[model samples]
Target: MIAGRMALGILVALEVAAGCRRGPAPAEPVKVIVTKNGWEPWKIPARKGEKLVLLVTRTTDETCATELVIPEAGVNVPLPLGKEVRIELTPERTGPLRFSCAMKMFQGVIEVR
Candidate 1:
């Protein structure tokens, strides 16, 4: 009886350890909204060397899509009318990078720290 009880306890411990190892890791994707004036929540914070994805939607037709610019990355993406665009960025350093619309009327910043 004593040996049987010990074996049962070991099996329960092993099951609990296996369950913990199979759990998923936590990862939350950041989201931002683009508006006629500029990027809603324009200032965003990201860790250096981390990958970030930006979903840019044109709320108005006044701003040309081609005008969107990220000088630091040399990325110029055009925004189509009434459409959502995705931009991916990886911060190589800790600093603020500027992103603006073609006419330079709409602007925002991405802060990597």
Candidate 2:
């Protein structure tokens, strides 16, 4: 009975420790719609180190889809039309990150604060 109690105590202690330990909280994904004209939100504000998941959905039937050109990150992603694309952005610095379409006519900015 004593050994069983000790084992139970150890298990309880381990459970408590495991509860106290926490991994990174799940990141909140941001949903943004993309149109032929431009991005739904011309400017989006985000905090540094915060995970930014952009759910870009194409809204136009035109051959144009939102293309993100992040010079800072050196990432270029082409968002297809009639479809959704997930883009993760973890800004290391606080500044404005520009994004545009292939034609460069449509543009948006991601402001990292």
In terms of lDDT, the best-performing candidate is 2
- The collision pairs in model 2 are none
Stretches of model 1 off by over 4 angstroms after superposition: 1-29, 64-66
For model 1, which pairs clash?
65-78, 65-79, 67-102
Weakest 10 consecutive residues of candidate 1 by summed lDDT = 10-19
lDDT of each: 0.60, 0.64
lDDT of 1 at 7: 38
Off by over 4 Å in 2: 1-23
Worst 10 residues of 2 by lDDT: 9-18
lDDT of 2 by residue, 49-93 (tens): 665667778877664655766544555677677677777756766
